[model samples]
Target: MPRETPRSSRVGSRIQRVLGQVISADIRDSRLGLSTVTDVEVTKDLSAARVYISALGDREAAGQAVEVLNERAPYLRHRVAQAMSLRHTPSLRFMPDYSQADSDRIRSLLNSGPAGEADNKE
Candidate 1:
């Protein structure tokens, strides 16, 4: 049998934890505001990681926030390297988290009622 690869959750979680600290204290990007690290997805070789963020502010600000993160990727990676004892630190890539929006959409759909139920009630 072939050896199974490790799930992203395990590696991603660790990266997220360290990144949260670095962003709050080390990074000096004023454009990023009231954000939470929702999750991270690390590649199998651990060469790169996608950091998912959920911001508690205007939707329009997300673009600028992402730009700031991408620009600071190198600094963030360096910070991670110093903090973590990994053989190789993966490059960081920021991505917006849409899970919250998906949840809201599902809630709205459910509130609309079953497909035929609304018609029957009418």
Candidate 2:
């Protein structure tokens, strides 16, 4: 049986949804071009949230995107608070989500390298 989702997790999901919309439509900064809100991880106490962002660019550009988001975190948090009725909105912290790039690299490596060549030697 699937475990019940905690309140913090539920809140985090809501935050992620709000952020996705807010970042896409509300904020129109050129530095954040093609950036997406990938995930939101809320602390157990729900005091703060780490928002993961996947940006369309190289590492430096991605880092700049994150910096731009972090700079506007207060506004983003307020946007989330407006969307949600939580008594206290968690502080938002923008972070670069590198999992996508890492997975792509791993996939390329696996595809380019031989698969278990030593295993066939018996």
Candidate 3:
């Protein structure tokens, strides 16, 4: 028999999906330029969640998007509750996911003349 998925993991995935749909289809804020829910981390008690958001625009715009999302978290929570049959919807705290930025920084460093000063010396 296969192992069962953890409850927290299930809730996190569901929250990620619901928030993505709500933001894309329901919210109409321009600051949210091409934003998507990258991931979600839900507490074991399922009382709260940290929703990671990613966007395709300037950092300022993405930051504004996170602010907007956080401000509308209650409404989003209601929407999620309506969509799911959970007794308690996780409280959403929107945060800007720095995954892309970090990856880009790493890539730039990697592409910047080999790897170390030793290589440039040779």
Candidate 4:
């Protein structure tokens, strides 16, 4: 059976949804590439939120996109506040999500077989 999600996580999910929509529809910065809000983590007291984002490009481009998002976080937060019905809108913090990249690397290694075995055959 699937475990129940925590209250903070539920709130985080809502925040993620609002943030993704706001970023895509409202924010207009060329530096910000095609970004997707991968996840959100909210504090227990709901004081702050850490938003994970992934960009469709190389590492440098993704970093640039994150910088743009961080620079425009206040405006995005305001937009999110307008959309959400929370007692207080959590402070937004943008972060690069590298989980996808890490997973891809692991998958490639697995497909390539064990490094020790390859070295032994040589």
Q: Going through the candidates in order, what is the number of backbone clashes in each?
A: 0, 0, 0, 0
State, as a TM-score between 0 and 1, how close model 1 is to the true structure.
0.74
lDDT scores for all predictions?
A: 0.78, 0.84, 0.84, 0.84
Work out the TM-score per prediction: 0.74, 0.83, 0.83, 0.81
Q: What is the lDDT of candidate 3?
A: 0.84
lDDT of 2 by residue, 4-118 (tens): 2498889988898888888888888888878888888888777888889988766666788899999998898888989999889999899999877778778888986676776
- For candidate 1, write residues 23-111 as lDDT tens digits: 88876666888777888888877778888887665555566677788898898899889877789888899988767756777888999
Best by TM-score: 3
Per-residue alpha-carbon lDDT of candidate 4 for residues 1-122, written as tens digits (9 for 90 to 100): 12324977898898899888888888888888888999888888778888998887666667888899999988988988888889888898888988777787788889999779978987
Give residue 54's error in model 2 in angstroms.
1.0
Q: Rank the candidates by TM-score, best first.
A: 3, 2, 4, 1
Candidate 3, residue 53: the lDDT equals 88
Q: How large an RMSD does model 4 have?
A: 4.1
* Error at 8, model 3, angstroms: 1.0
Off by over 4 Å in 2: 1-5, 114-122
- State the local distance difference test value for candidate 4: 0.84
- Give lDDT: candidate 1, residue 113: 82
User: Candidate 3 lDDT, tens digit per residue, 1-122?
Assistant: 12323998898898888888888899998778888899888888888888988787557766988999999999999999999999888888988987886787788888876657777697
